[model samples]
Target: MGFSSRTFLVAPDDTLWRLSTSKFDRMLRDPASHSLPTFARQRARMASVVVELVASEPMRVMRTTYSVLAFDAEGRLDPSRFEEQQFALVESVVAPVIASSAEENNQPVVDATARFIAQGGRWTPSPALARAIDEAALEQRPCGRL
Candidate 1:
């Protein structure tokens, strides 16, 4: 399938804000440039990676409900083939940011995923493809940490 054709959802636990508060639109609008929102920053990094991996196609999303849909090259979702794309997206985009920031904290992203999987986190692709497709916008922004 073409790059933009498949749709996926962002896990609630993996929300970008949960990764960093400095990312809060509210925070960005204000004057006090405080410490980087570490979680948000890291998550934002991961989110950027995901978009890059799933590049080229346009993604439509609903913000309030956080629903996302990507038009597959074939215009359909193949359940068996979905996870590879999902994992790759997660690994490519999200992992580096996780590696970059929380690398110091030693936060267990893989562990978290393992736990989620252990808890029966099925591979149901979300209709919402996890908004924030602008990797350029995000990558251009400086990370608080190296």
Candidate 2:
């Protein structure tokens, strides 16, 4: 069996502890606001568990899978349905964090993050992204620096 993962580059001023703490705190303070039918208050509490698991680790890996609706028994792609699902994930989960971080740091809006998925669910970053990751690695600050 194979699995896929997405790695987020933590900026110099950010730490997994800080990010996790902030997220946990925010969810705690506004449970009603963050709650969704699929992600209710109990589901939100799982964030603390995840934070605990990764606190002492520099990098944590989690498995993720994409959702697709099957309109046919043969499992063919439905472009419109697929696009709608992807856009919803991006808009609801991905965009807000990216936009907020950009705004906080006074960075330009990132129209897209390029992704190349190879056979067996491998991810290959573009040259520019690879360079950025390398640069970010060099700039990692001491834990709790910010």
TM-score list, all predictions: 0.20, 0.23
Worst 10-residue lDDT window, candidate 2: 43-52
lDDT of each: 0.33, 0.34
| Top lDDT model | 2
What digit string (tens of lDDT, one per residue) describes model 1 on residues 47-126? 32222223644333222212222223332322233344445445555566766687688775554553343223233323
Q: What is the lDDT of residue 97 in candidate 1?
A: 73
lDDT of 2 at 116: 19
**TM match of model 1 to true structure:** 0.20
